[model samples]
Target: MTILSDIPRLLPEGMALGPALDRALAILERAGFSAVIYDYTPVPRSHDGSLITPNILEARRVPEDMLALWKSGFYQLDPVQDAALATAAPFVWSGLGKQSRVMDEVIRERHRPVLGYMHDMRFSFGVTVPIHQPRGDLATFTAIRIDAEPDFAADAAEIVPQIGVLGQIFHDVVSAGFDAETRRTHHVRLTPRERECLSLCADGLTAKEIARRIERSVPTVTLHLNAASRKLGARNRFQAVARAAHYRLIEAAPAA
Candidate 1:
């Protein structure tokens, strides 16, 4: 079966970035992976700021020289970096073109060693899926293949959407200051009424159902739900429950 079809079985129980990435790569490899790396570049902190990728790969996992070059910011000049920054969708790059004036020098002089290693090692083609945020930041999933497999591209295409979901989860964890592992133990301090309302809401309860459960009027339940929604910055009841669940403020099954 394709990796995409096996996502449900592959995904770990937690939402932390490290586990998420590991699981994603496992799915790729199990489905015959070459090399898969997710790259994230946040906009500079200032107007003339620098890009950053959170060094998600472990020390022993990458070649030392490549890690050093990445740490030194050489990849900022890489054309693939440019391409990801230019678009919000996925794209493919087989190799550098002679006419790629902006990228030619960097690829030839600085990045060639790694490029050649990949080429000599039989890594031929790659697909990069860009994950763009509303804040003008970009994250990427770059999957590489070693040989002339025609269907590798199409097979890899199937998993990108699931990877995209993990990307969004990554953003949320970063923004929330708590990874999935920590979230499982986190306790968001909610008022008694708020917890009561959210708990019932999660159980597929309408405002009326919740109100009757709590012996409050429907409008009062609606008011509590709206207040919780506003405080949680959620768009609606369903989102409020999801957020509440994420923060450990409510249970998945909700209170009966």
Candidate 2:
């Protein structure tokens, strides 16, 4: 708890991304890690579970080739990313071991080459913190402890809660500068009217009901819904509501 409490003190005065990251790395180092990677994705995946490209990636003390691979669709095969999506908790992982049935299946069925690459690079021990934001962004904090002994994973496991706190704080400070990009990505945008229409749609209202609720004509509602559908890359209004909710572009409340 004290360790996490100390992180804000270590953070930079103005919370600039570069300096804040440098300080974050220092905290990780003091905690026995040698390398750190921080990645923030505005859109992590689509409603149908396809990988979306990340918009930002930052790293220190990691290999250049590894960073290059991350940009080149390597994240699609990363088991850490898969696991992170499944749980909000932090986890300790080894590049060498048979971790779990799910991870093992991912490795055997698809991601073995990624694990092999990790083994050959000697960045074999690490912990990853999955920091999912309220507006549906994902920022992962990963720390690697190179040349770790046999018991390193256990030690890493014990400190996950502290690490999770530190990771979230770092993400909050760094994201203070990202107000301009929060609601819309380069690939998609929904108008205020479009979002309102979709939010109502997600609540299971028919087009006529939505029109009456928003005091708009049925044709106007149809246009906005269609526009949202087009922007979301959906086949139709139903798919648009689904994608919009998943992207956090609209309210996800259950239909009443």
Candidate 3:
């Protein structure tokens, strides 16, 4: 099975970043790679100005200290990360033994010594994918090989576009999720009667019919439905029902 086969099962509801990325990493590993890094940056200027997604997870198979340095904020100074941020190009970094232009610059500048430190520790061959969000956020996916065995460049070249496609789905799903959460947080406190009337109306029951079923006056049912519609910012009953269904505030029952 290809890596794409596992995409469906890996995505679960809630906790967007970690679980989803770990799944991608696991797929790369199965394909004989070593470490995978999936980084999603919303905006350069964070609300509090600190790095938002600072090293979400370090897989067990990856080097321990490499993970530690990442958590310690070494990436903020890593020249390769700077270069990648400047442009969305992926390339290989050779050994740091008097070579590896990328590593040497990082080491000489001492911007973030972690990458140089990693040279002596582990020989990782990996691929990095930079995901650009519609809202202008930047995300990256990096896969590292153990003992320099796997060729991540080849794998990444093949899979980056596929991941890019998935990025759109991720954006849509997450945006829907955020809108849902906002609605929940600012949920309108409706009376049980009002909710009931709206639910029935959404099922295509006339105000008079809803009143009969719920033991309320026709005007009262109309009042409840109208109030619900206004609260949901819907122009009419149909729109109200559609919004409620989209927000999952109502079950997806068939229209009567």
Candidate 4:
């Protein structure tokens, strides 16, 4: 039996994105997963300042309706997406305690229209790997195993690290072909003061608090933020912070 440890060596080299992902998914399928979906969000926010829906880089055995619903804005209500952004670890969907409760409540109260979506789609069990980029972008790779045995989650846990490595490798391989224009657009530069303001904002500091901490007046800090936003082509302060982090102009760490 091919164990999880052998998965890394199974990835094919020098192939197109589709073929490469097909090879990767084959390995996961052999390991008991029924399907896999890899989603990437290069820019997490849209130009109008709302969070962007992730683009499906590759998928095997996913329902077309689910993809349609996700692109049509239902992803904002997706509990899996919510959990992916909140942590940097691989997690089992059935074992996501608070997230599971929230998803149940969302189905019962808010998104009642899609109440039986998961069951209808046969997505009862899954594992999600949230890949963190240095620039703060998050990419997710999920493997779904429907009607899995009771011990599936426990067995899956042993392969989480390997799954994460696969996710990163998959992301890099796909992202390498991004258009030069897109790459150039995302690599904007920031001045030192602008970087300082954005870095402080990432640490959860308010404008006034940042001003006090950096020994600058509130208006000065605000001015720096505005400039950074303009240079980064961001529509708002939050988007500006996210863009700056993506470009590595500012670190995404909290203040000590």
Q: Residue 114's C-alpha lDDT in candidate 1?
A: 50
Worst 10 residues of 1 by lDDT: 96-105
In model 4, where do residues sit more than 4 Å from their true spots? Answer: 1-9, 45-50, 95-115, 181-256
For candidate 2, lDDT tens digit of each residue in 1-256? 1356556578744587788878888888766888988888877886667566566778888877987897787877788788877777787677876474445444445677778778887765777889987767788998888777777767776776787888888888888777656435544678889989998888878999999999999999999999888888899888888788777677756645
Pairs that clash in candidate 2 = none
Instruction: Give me the runs in candidate 1 sitting further than 4 Å from their true place.
Output: 6-9, 44-46, 49-64, 95-122, 147-256
Error of 1 at 56 (Å): 4.9
TM-score of 3: 0.49
Q: Is candidate 2 or candidate 4 better by lDDT?
A: 2
Number of backbone clashes in candidate 1: 0
Q: State, as a TM-score between 0 and 1, how close model 1 is to the true structure.
A: 0.49
- Kindly indicate the candidate among 3 and 4 with the higher lDDT: 4
Q: Write the per-residue lDDT of candidate 1 for residues 119-224, one digit (tens) a residue.
A: 5556555566666766454566666566747766666557655545544544454434444443232223467799789988888888988888899999999898
Tell me the TM-score of each prediction against the true structure: 0.49, 0.74, 0.49, 0.61
Compared with the true structure, model 2 gives a TM-score of 0.74
Backbone clashes in model 3, listed as residue pairs? 35-144, 37-142
Best prediction by TM-score: 2
lDDT agreement with native, every candidate: 0.58, 0.77, 0.55, 0.69
lDDT of 2 at 147: 75
Give per-residue lDDT, candidate 3, residue 20: 56
